[model samples]
Target: MIPDPDEQVLVDVRAPLREMIFPFLETIVITGVLWIVIGWFDAADAGRYGVGPLRLPPEWRNGFVYLWVMLVLWRFVLPLLRKRRRRMVVTDRRIIFRADGFRARPRTLAMSAVTWAEKERGLLAVYLQDSDLPVYYSGLPKIRKIARMINDPLI
Candidate 1:
C-alpha cells in the first residue's frame, strides 16, 4: 500500500547483515576445499612429490578449477547483489521491509501494534500485541539510538 500522506519516514536503510553470514561462510568453506583439492592436483602437474608421471594436462585442470570456483562463489555473490535491492524503512506509523525489487508487496509492521522493544542476542526484538513471538532485526549502525527510538513512546 502507498504510505499515508501524514506518515513520516524515520529511517531508510539496508536490511541486517545477519541474513548474509551463513551464505558467505558456506561459500567460503566450499571454495576453500575446492582450491585445496585443485592445489593437490596441480602439485603433480608441477612435477612435485614424485607424482610427475601422473600429471594430467594443466590447461583442462585450470579451467575446471576456475569454473568450479565461479559456481561455488555465485551462491554468496547472488545474495550480496540482491541484498542491495532490499531495504528497511522505519516510519512513524510503521516499519516497511522491502525484500527485493521483484517483490511487489512489502512486509510491514505497524508501530501501533508494537507492545515493546528489547535487545536480544545481538538483535533488536520487537514484541507485538497481535503475536506471541517477537520480530528481530540487526545491522543498524547506531544500535543504541535505534533501540531508544523503538522504546520511546513519543517517537
Candidate 2:
C-alpha cells in the first residue's frame, strides 16, 4: 500500500503462508477419509470381487461434493486470498491494517494515540491511553523489537 502524503512506512508485511498449514492438512485428511470410504465401498461389487470405479449414492455424492467445495473454499482458497491481499503497515505517523476481504478501508491507528506497545507471545500489542484493550499485530518477526520500536519513536 502507498503511504499517505508526508508519511514514511517502516513496516509493510502480510501474514506468512505457514499460518495456513493446519487448514491445508485438515482438507487433506477429510478428502482422504472420503476417498477411502468411497473406494472401499466400490471395491468388490455387491460385496463380491471385482475392480471398479468408486461410486456413492446420488444424494450422498452431491452432499460430499458440496462439502468438499465448502472445505476447499473456506479453508484453503479464502485464506490464501486473504493472506495475499492483506497487509500490516507501520508508518512513522500511524499503524495501518488492510484486508481486502475484511474491510474497504484500512484500519488506521495514529502513533500519537498509542501510549504503549508491548510484545505478548508472538504478537505486538499496542495500548491506547483511551482504551483498556490492546490491539494486536500478528505474523511479525522479531515481535519484541517491533513492539519497542512502535512504543518508542526514538528507536
Candidate 3:
C-alpha cells in the first residue's frame, strides 16, 4: 500500500524545468529598448566631456550585443534559475524528485529509513509525519493518481 503516515513531505515536480520556455523575442525586445536608452545616455556623457561627436563605439554592434545576451542567458542564467528551483528535498527517510526527462533523477522514498516528513501547502497549513513520506506528482503526466492517493490517504 502507499504509505500514508499522517504526515508526508513532497517537493515541487515542475521545479526541474523551471522557465523551460526561453523568451527569445522578449529578451531581444527588452535588450533593444535598454540599448537605445543607453545610447542616449552615452550621447549626453560625450557632450558633457566635450568629445568630438556622440559617436557610438565601433564594437557596439547590435548583432554582437544580441549574441552576447543570448550566450549569457543560455550558459549562465538558465542553469542558475533551474538550480534555484525546488527540485529535490532531503527527508529523514527518502528523497523526492521527478524521474522524467532525459537528465532527471528518479523519485525514491523508503519508509523504514525515514524518521520524519513535512509537507506545506499555501494557506493549507503543514502536514508532518514521523513514519512515512508522501511521493506525489504535481506537474508531471498521470499525476492525478498520485494526488488522489495523497488526498484520501491510508496507511
Kindly report which residue stretches of model 2 are placed more than 4 angstroms away from their true locations once superposed.
Answer: 37-67, 83-86, 99-101, 129-133, 138-141, 152-155
Q: Which stretches of candidate 3 lie over 4 Å from their true place?
A: 1-12, 16-29, 37-52, 62-95, 98-108, 111-119, 123-147, 151-155
Candidate 3: what lDDT? 0.47
Clashes of each: 0, 0, 2
> Clashes in model 2: which pairs?
none
- Top TM-score prediction, candidate number: 2
Full-model lDDT for every candidate: 0.73, 0.74, 0.47
Scored by lDDT, model 1 comes in at 0.73
Ranking by lDDT: 2, 1, 3
lDDT at position 10, candidate 3: 44
Model 2, 25-144: lDDT tens digits are 988987887776555555534554553444445566557667777878888888778776667788889888875465546888889899998888878899997999998866755666
CA lDDT, candidate 1, residue 128: 96
Model 1 agreement with the true structure over 114-144: per-residue lDDT tens digits: 8887777777688999899998775544555
Query: By the TM-score metric, which is better: model 1 or model 3?
Result: 1
How far off is residue 69 in model 3, in Å?
0.6
Instruction: Tell me model 2's lDDT, rounded to 2 decimals.
Output: 0.74
* Local error of candidate 1 at residue 119 (angstroms): 2.2
- Candidate 1, pairs of clashing residues: none
lDDT of 3 by residue, 27-142 (tens): 56666776776566566556755554766664555565666577668755666554444344333345455433446655555535433333334111123354243434343422
